[model samples]
Target: MIEVNFDGIVGPTHNYAGLSIGNRASFANAGAVSSPRLAALQGVGKMRRMLAMGLGQGVFLPHVRPNTDWLRTLGFNGSDTETLASAWMSDRALVANAMSASAMWTANAATVSPAPDTRDGLCHLSVANLSTMPHRASEAGQTERQLRLAFPDPRFFRIHAPLPAAFGDEGAANFMRIAPRSGGPAVEMFVYGEGQSGGFPSRQHRTASEAVARRHGLSPARSLVVRQSDAAIAAGAFHNDVVAVANGHVLFAHEAAFADPAALYAALAALVPDVVTIEVPADRVSLDTAIRTYLFNSQLVTMPDGGMTLVLPGEAQENAAVWAWLNELIAQGGPIDRLEVVDVRESMRNGGGPACLRLRVQVDADALAAIDPRFLLNETVCARLEQVITQEWPESIAPEELGDPRLWDRCARARSALTEALGFGTDEL
Candidate 1:
């Protein structure tokens, strides 16, 4: 019963490339961060970053991470990052079965958080036991239902065995108790929470979220919570939700990883909606690792033709005030058609863009119904990697082209604050 929906997105390939180690690892070249059309869009966002490691971050293998000059200076091209990187690598699933990846998490105890379920294609969410992974308990040999699905699946409802400590969650596997509420099923959805394995001060994540709300019978104190806590948020950051959306309406970002940004914005305004929050103050030079990365590096998507596409972080105005208030709420009606960000911070900074790194998975409404907006409006991989960097440095022998033209006009106003935060229309990118 893992149908699934939450606006899934996953990657920031931005015209990716493969082979690297330049500047003289023996001059293998390539490296300015790969091109030839961002290595065909990093072979398709490396397949939704390997399905966003099953909605968490247990990424068993995933490798490759070049950056593609952050999608060739923002405007994508090379065919809209190769049509969303070759449809996320023709729907991946084989890097030796994504390195035998594992996932699971369950804990509703009414509404402490973490639900989204799935099975074979991996996404269970919380079950319990501990020792994580198929219940890899202590490992030496491994069993307990495979170490309780091996990590992740935190808990669902009525679990025990020393598991909860306010979800300080030691290696979860799967668990959930939600489903009932008078006719049991749809809780209208909306929980946000993000600190302390969350489920809260744990009673085994509230007795496995009240035994998955009494095995789908429902009613756990009405439901609906919106936290952002952060006792350091680990168990792989409480098994990330990849921008959740099972009709829950989400948009969470609580930066204190360094500690106290107004107590992580009052624990994310007590849990979501001020328009799904996106304050981003990271003390000053902002971007809190792109808010712990909005699902494997970037997204807003919904194209095919109707509209809405922000992808994010490749400076067209530095999140242009969050894509110009989401392009004026998509010009009042809010049906966004295109935005796409992706930045490598001018080629490597302590962070990348859109959201530091990448992760997320699941997407197939017939390949997002075939997105477009003329595919990030294209100009051909930024006019072909600016004609291969002024033809391998020859504007008469580069040296930053002999220096200032106002340092290329302050690097074009710090790249126009990330291309005016991506509202587009600088004559259509």
Candidate 2:
């Protein structure tokens, strides 16, 4: 068995429009110029690194932003130019929301249940409705198609629709899985920020978490629903992945990550003995500092050698508190033994980190083999993707450029090239 990571490639429409209201980095870098080409390459570079580590890696195609379907839904009519003009004239912010390349963050793509954990003995994936935010809400439809195409065997894989809009599901970004061993029985943890938040909008609703557990056929005994701390959410931890991460038996989290950290650990310990809980107190690394450095968002991966590796963004290395804490953690010789920091500055500026970019799936050899071959990261595929990004992706994009008559053609061409390169259909983007 292996933990296959399906990473979303940053789309050509990548820009900092300050679309995510609570995302601190997004707001801070709102009007800054964005590099879509660099973003895509950075993601591919991470995929390459995962492959180099003898880990399973796959890629999710980007969402085609400036989406005509979304524009149509918003009542824009007539020719492409006419629709673009009308949308921009009516509400520039709506245009920015529709043109968000946020689909690249696959952690929010779906809530997945491995075959071992599901009642039917088949892997179940529920696409997130993302009903809380306009920008993210548009992703459910395309993500469903992508999942179906990737796992075509109905007998082995069941892809379920997103929960109702009222439920406000935000997918795996708020979900975590922990197992005794790589192929052992698992405990599913669903973390939801409360509704009616005082500071940031709580993205994941509690009802939505329960609905997903039911939809996935996960028993109550094997699942735990945890509330995310309002303080963490207030400090720009928009998603639970931003505050806590888990791999195998280890749960690395900030003390303020959950409303009841002790209860979470005790529940997990009840299911699996010797569960390792590495808690970083607020005093040691302030919540503000943690959000700035994305310390918790780093990918905690189990290596082939039985040790864990922290795949972090370059931003982590630049933060003094985060860097010092990492060194100390390794010096103590815990589960995490190595660290691989990669330059994902483009994504970092937009408030996504290494873990935010990938959806982790636990699968056996057969399920892993069934994934689309073209989407797998190998030397040749990685090279081809980088080439397509270099030639077709825009070097820089401004929020205003989303309405440019010329921008659609550029974005379309890039999407087409990527779809072709990745063996996806015309509808993929």
Candidate 3:
């Protein structure tokens, strides 16, 4: 079996409009000019870094943005140009929702269960019905179509439609799995948030978590549902990935991440053997600092060696407390032995870190070989993608420019060129 990290390519329309309610970074950087070219290349560069580290790396192409279909659904009528102008004049918020580029953060793409963990012994994936945020809710249908296109063999992989909007499933960002090894006996952890009266929004509802687990056919004995702290949510941890991350047997989380930390850890210990729980104390790294630096949002990946490595965003290094905690964790390492930091400031400012960019999909060797080869990234593929991004992607994008007719043309050109280069047919995108 092999674990492949599928990283989403940042879209050409990426901008900050203060869209996400509970994301502090998005709010802080609202109305700032964004570099679409830099964002896409930076994400691809991270993919290349993962490949260089001898890890399996795959790429998910960005969906068509400035989605005219969405605008039409919002009751805007006329030619694409007229519709955009009318929508801009009528409701800028609706225009913003239609033009969202949040699909780059594929951590919320879907909830995937490996073949070994599923009831039918076939890998299962449920596209996230991101109903909490209007911008993100539009991604569900396109994401599901893309997943099915990528893995066409239904016998090996099963793709489930998004749950009803009432469930509000946010996908893999709130879900984690710990296996004894790569192949079997995978214990799944589903983390949810209580959407109560609070300063911040709780995106992951408890009922949504339960619905996803049942839809995915996860084993009850090996599955657990834990609650995210109300304090953490109010502190701007919109999703659980902001405060907790797990890989294999290691779980790196903040002290205030969960409502019942002791019970969760004890249950994990009971489910999986030799589970390593690395909890960063609030004193060592305050919740405010953790949310700010995205220290715990780092991806804890099991390296080629038996040990693990932490893939962190550059912001973590800039913060003194988070940086010190990193050093301490490395010094006292058992599972995690190395730290690798990458610059993703473009995505970081929009509240996405290294872990937020990728989805962890485990597939057996044969199933892995069956995957679409065009999506796999190596040195040559990475270079070609970078060249395309540099030439085709716009250097910068402003919020007001989203209504420009030229923007759609340029985005279409870039997306078309990318899909053609990737050998993906029309249905694939």
Candidate 4:
């Protein structure tokens, strides 16, 4: 099966409101001016890079911003503009949550099981509830709608709704799979965090991960659930992806990534006999330095030429320690042969890196065809997206400008234009 990376386009209302409590960069850059146009362009640029490498690339449209419907549920009433104004006056934080573009981090969009690993031999995807944070909790409905539209063929795909809020699910960010190749039986690892006092909250619950594995029909023998290291969480590695990522048989991670690394490794080795474990010890790279540079958040993807490549953020290159380790890794002639760095500084300021920007779906030829063609990317699609972003997206957004009626109108128009350019009807998106 081939792997397709579906990236969420940065929204017209993309800003730094520091909504994610556990994300260190978000808090550090809170209230900073955001350039929506630049953010969208940078996202499209990443897509272009993927396309150039002969990888399958797709786009997830931005969700409608200034979610007036949500505001109405909070007791605000009137036209969309009027409701936004009233809500802003009463509770600015509430309005900020409504306008969030967190959906751009599509890695949190869902937990997916490819056909090769499922009981019925059909791809299964469970949308994440994201119930931990208030701003993110409101994303489930829209996420489901988009998934349903993109994967309409029930014969080849089954898209399940988000789990109940009681079990907090954060999707693929906390999930990993190890296999000899994409089109084969694999070991699915679900990493969760136990709640603790006096630190950032643990978003993914053990019960939630178990439910997803059960719903996906994954075999008990091949499904492994483990706890994320409390130290990693306290160190600002909010998601497991922030500390570890797996592609095919390679598991690249920090030594302190899991609560019990030795046991987890033994279990994984039993499941995949030829599994390659590339561990970066704390002495070589501290967790603090890793999180600061987002070294582990790099996308570990298999290239069309059958070689593995790490798509890292530019910040990784700027750090001396991180860069030294990466260079040494390549020189040692390991499974990871090369590194390709891309600039996503706009998204990086809010703590999302290469791996955070996209969701990886493994599909065979027939299954790939079942997906909506409009969602897939090509040279023409990229060009059209770039044009829409350049002409419609706002150049800059100050924190205080979020409540302005004019800003709301621009965001709405930008999304509408993007949908039209992508051949999607306004009502469909």
Candidate 5:
């Protein structure tokens, strides 16, 4: 096997994604490729954005508690999402639930899936967890900028018109959005569409998922429901850009979409101009987590002194030591602004992570320009989303708030404000 020394340029940089993608390879334009699913690739362009990792397979014993020793190898968990403490460990795995204890949380959480729209941090969807959007509040340049988010009441439960069911769950927005820290506009996301199988939650899990969506003022259709397939199993989908630093050729794959692997692989080849497959052996359990997973990880934004921190990848993989490798690189003067690690013990106790809990935005140069960074600060952004109509969004809110519109504004304003202030960057007074 030929080794691509990522330690050179790419190595000295920080990669929150545990992507141990080969560095010696080259890249192909994602546009040149073709896929039956994408009539036109909305996310991709000539210059693409960077993605976290390729396909992932969480290997663990059946009926295993998410984070525990004796699992062997580079320690991983049944669930990808884990607490910050566990995530930053040289070898640790925590359950996503551990990090999600708020009134508005779900069990299906996977990865936070960072995006540039999020201004450069984790894109999450926990209606129960969101309190205040991170902001400087003091002065403009006095504190610099990332995102200007004005959170709305989660109990508001405002509904968007032209319901998802009325149409085919067309314009569904998921919990994904841009990081306000990066100072970008918030982007609507839909992890799954309403009409799809996982579209509208049915059983308890489904209902719970919907409730959280409604609580956070997200569109059900925003989620990517794995359309029925002969492949035996299905899950959600993630759209992201995969840049093969080793190959120079940028391969774009929708990392979020855990639908039909083969079909997705084909679609990726189509949407991406150049395609080099990055595969991890498929295990039924891992596949299940992949489809119905929600895990999130983040790093602290660099301070004025040029220091920033990010939540690290807890467990280690054959080549996926997101924490160990990056930490060492930073210590070696990797040119990183700064890095911060969180325990997310609270989130893990509830079952979630920095990654699985949030959302992201489009990083494409052209698409990014059209967006107004100020939208992140709109006090009514969340409420507005509740009322806006989009072919891609869903017609129904989450079950609890499904038909009702009050749930959107129910979150305690004072409590939320305090939590968000601390969550983003505000220090104790």
Candidate 6:
């Protein structure tokens, strides 16, 4: 099976509103001016890098921002412009939530079980309710719509609606799959947190993880539900991906990532005996340094030549501690043989890294072909996307400009132009 990395196109409304509660970078960069055009271009550059590496690459379009429809449900009624203005006057925070571009972090879009691992032999995806944050709760419906359009063939895909909001599912960011290789039966690990930690709420509930597992028909023996370390969460590791990431037979994580690392490692070893774990000790890179630099958030992808590469954000390269440890790991000839750093400063400022920006899906040849062609990326597609972004996306957006009707109109038109450029209809996206 070919593993495809479907990245969410950075939206025109991309801003530093600091909507996420536990994400330190988001809070630190809140209210700062953002470069929407640069953000989108950077995301496209990442996709292009993946393509150049001979990996399957796809795109998930941005959602309609300044969600005036959601405001109507909240008792604001009028034309879109009028509603937005009134909502802005009544509650600036509400308007900010409505205009959030957090959906570009596609890792939180859904939890997917590939065709090889499900009982029905079809890929199963459950849209995350994201109930933990008010700004993110409204994404489920639109996310489900996009997933359905991308994987329409019932024979190869089953898209489930978001679980009830009470469960508070946050999707693939808190989940990991370990197999001998891609496209094979593997052990699925669900990392959940309990109670509040370090003044931040633990987003993924254990019950929610169980619900997704059952919905996907995963057997108990192959599924392990574990707890995320309170220390890590308190350190601002809002999602498990921030502290750990698994690809193929390797699990690269910070030492403080899980509550009981020994047991989790033992369980994984039992399931996949040859599992290669590269755990970075706190002495080398403290939890604070790891979270601050997003050292563990790198994309640990298997290259076409059977070697693994860590696609890290530029932040990791800037920090002396993080960079030294990575260099040492490479010098020692660890599972991660090479490092490739890409600049996603706009996203990094908003608390998302390379891994958070994309959703990984493993699909066989037939299932791969079943996906919508427009969502797939190539050199031509990337060039067209770059052109559209340059021409249409806003150059910069300050916090005060979020409520501007003119900005809203530009954002809408940018999405429209993107849709047309991709040969999608107005209603299709």
lDDT against the true structure, per candidate, is: 0.28, 0.88, 0.88, 0.94, 0.24, 0.93
Cα error, candidate 6, residue 31 (Å): 1.1
- Model 1 lDDT tens row, 215-316: 433334443323323432321233222222121222323343223345433443343323232333445323323333332234443333434354554443
Regions of model 2 farther than 4 Å from truth: 182-184, 427-429
lDDT string for model 5 (6-59, tens) is 000000001111111111010111112121111101111000111111111110
Model 4 per-residue lDDT at 192: 98
Model 6 TM-score, all chains together:
0.99
Q: List where candidate 5 sits over 4 angstroms from the true fold.
A: 1-259, 275-277, 283-285, 288-342, 362-429
TM-scores for every candidate against the unseen true structure: 0.22, 0.97, 0.97, 0.99, 0.30, 0.99
Q: What would the per-residue lDDT of candidate 3 be over residues 199-314, giving only the tens digit for each residue?
A: 77677778878877787788889889999999899888888999999999888899999999999999988888678888999999999999998987788887888679999999
Report the C-alpha lDDT of model 2 over 1-429, residue by residue, as the tens digit.
Answer: 678899999999999998887899999999888999999998999999999998988889887767767887889988776777799999888888877899999999999999988899889999999998889998999999888888878867899988889888988989988888544678999999885455679999999999989888998998999999999888899999999999888999999999989888899998977678999988889998889999889999989899999998888898888889889999999889998998888999998999999998887888888876766777888889999999999999986788887887798789899899777667554
Model 2 pairs whose backbones collide: none
lDDT against true structure, model 3: 0.88
Instruction: Give every collision pair in model 4.
Output: none
